[model samples]
Target chain A: MALENVALEHVPSGYGVYVGFFRDVTNADFLHQQLLSRNRDFEYAFIDASSVISRLHLLSAVYSALNTLLVGALRTPNVHSEIVTSFNTNNNIADAYRRWGITPGKTKDLIVVKIISPTAEGQNGFSATSARTPEAIWAHLTEHVMGKPVPVTDSEIAQATDWPKVRKYYRLNGVPALEKVADKAEHQRKMEQLAIMGMALRGL
Target chain B: MAVPHQQQHQFPLPQILTHPSSSPALLITQGAEGRLYKTTHLFPDRPCALKYRPSKPYRHPILDARLTKARIAAEAKVLERCWREGVPVPAVYAMDAANGWLMMEWIEGVPVRQAINEYLGSGESQEGQEEAEELGDLMRRIGRVVGALHKTGVVHGDLTTSNMMLRRQEGEQKGVLGGEVVLIDFGLAMQSMSDEDRAVDLYVLERAFASTHPRAEKLFGMILEEYGKSFKKATSVLTKLEDVRMRGRKRSMLG
Candidate 1:
């Protein structure tokens, strides 16, 4: 149910992160409110799982958020909020929330992320300095989330993804290189590439 | 690394990399148009080339921004076209035309110029017939790539040996010209089906080879041979190339 903090390769040192997937998240509204109210105690970035296509799709957003956080260029209130917005294709913060952020009763399966670096303490919050161990984060998430944690693997993420919505969100439909691939798996891989590119090029 | 807070800054960086969380971006080159940097696209594991066109100090601010933005957009568009057509160019992963940076797939390889020069200067049994054969293959590979680009209706405006790269092959040793040719530095690239444009592209490289590596210039005929066999319309382009050669590298204003 839990894995050690995952250190992304080639990233600046000391930035490890833990991702959790959950199905049947009944308390998404409550979690979503905590974010709307900007409650520091519930500090995890709660993403709507169905919007996520794969581990890389989710991690790509996290990596962009962290990179922005380091450079002091965060658009949202904090890195966690910035992570929620990073998955978006534009700088529209509220639209990003509606698209990828949890919608209480609407978001059934959930993707919860907690960055494990001292710098993630953001501008204001629960002084994440002392209680950021992987175990501590898992215990806190399970206690509040009220959903069973699933491993954040590629297949698991795929199971929760809404492909049609994914295509619409990332503008992947009708892409020539994407449609050229007949094989299903190969096609999905190409779509993911374009999707990630869309996210990366948002401001450009 | 071009850290923003460094004691002695060489040049101003794009606003994207100014954050404390901004990953390190290393300047790869500074052409007259702009500077290129090697950095991650989003995730650290995913490396990308960032081409940034800084505002020209001499030009009017409005005109400078317009030119920079248009160039970035045009470059990204051509790269995307080539990628979709399977023309063996770097994929345009993302681009911010307004910011003057186009993030593209980071191609890994040495420049064709460096590889050719290294082999020519290797002095390892220069008398061996195998060396000439190996060099001939390299030239053919370069021609094929150029042919592929032109076939896709794109003319690489600045076609020098440096813009052509030889991607390192698995288990292949270096200094042998044993790699696939990949094009780079499309800052001046454009999409055109014109025979004149394609011919001029070939002529530019012809001049580059003769001046840069006189020893390898004799083998460039092999490039044309391979190019002529690449596409249905390439022969006509090659015919145009002979005319281009007679007219010299400089195009006539009256034409």
Candidate 2:
């Protein structure tokens, strides 16, 4: 379950995704250091889970990154990093990474995303089957990440969400219709819709 | 789907669509001016309506680009305005004027035309007084939506039943048209403050009703009555509508 990824039918054929939700992450500092050191092996996106609202919120970012990759319109360095930045409303690359990406002592609950796509001929030094196997990917993640891997479900995701931060990040306070929904669950659903739509229309 | 205007001589595609996947923009309409496609804006989870004004082969390149850019920009601006003013319309999600594509929120529902036809076909008259009152309620909702739109200082240039949708409510039974009214297809919409423009909007809708649902045409007055209660300016707009109807939607040049 940890290594096996979901394949979106509408996406280009080459890409596969592996996702995990972790409750207690203690090695964020080490992970951050690896990213800073440009360790090619540590290319997974380590999202600060508290900032994430739901599975859709996280997947929306993935969708944007993959769409950008398919068209070669990537705004960040790579598809992995772009998912980290896609949550923010604008294109301030550094701001998005700092706000949503992992921090050394600050992040506890964490969401990990690994995107494995076929590299073009003679590009990036990857062979045709480099990222196709789930076993190798799962073993590597388990060895590196210091947390118990869990399924990406709404109930689990909700436990990690910081509502105030999510609201401010998505500018939900400014929307009148959103403010009018009195039901708590209904309000959350509306907020998710608005947030996803907000990301889709980013830079517009 | 109609043949995409983007044929072999397709102009270079927009930078927004990075992947060269075979045209995933599913064509939804082939109107006189442009084609509408249902596609994702930035991700597969997000479904959006992409309206593309294909460069006309009959016109020069420069002229075609100018017109397409202007139309997309204009339509985008109007949609934004309607959304900000809380009018029930599809939100403008994204736009690439230079590429002639405008992405909008994909609204879900049946077109009011189909809903009305089904209601009338169901022999609404025999369904008791409750059905008739419910139909009136739906008409008033439409009137209120249009009133809100006009109050925002814009005019829907082409007012037709097909352009308005009746969003089916959750767990709603079939053939019972009730829910919010969402106005769509703002390609011809433009900024206008004139009572004449507002009146003409009503006249066109009235004509649409007369042509398609003559039996339901009697309920047209209920729409006006409700519109007058929507906004302060609605009274004058409804009054102008009567004058416009009397003149058959044309003013004499003799004056």
The top-ranked prediction according to TM-score is 2
The number of the candidate with the highest lDDT is 1
lDDT of 1 at A74: 69
For each candidate in turn, the TM-score is 0.74, 0.78
Q: Give the lowest summed-lDDT range of ten residues in model 1 chain A.
A: A122-131
User: Whole-model lDDT for model 2 versus the true structure?
Assistant: 0.78
- Residue B167 accuracy (lDDT) in model 2: 74
Deviation from native of the Cα of residue B194 in model 2, angstroms:
6.6
Clashes of each: 12, 4
**What's the true lDDT of residue B187 in model 1?**
83
lDDT of each: 0.79, 0.78
Pairs of residues at least 3 apart in sequence or in different chains that clash in candidate 2: A70-B18, A70-B19, A71-B18, A71-B19
- In the range B69-171, model 1's lDDT, one tens digit per residue, is 8899888777766765657777665565766777788888888898888888888528689777888878888888899999988999999998987887677
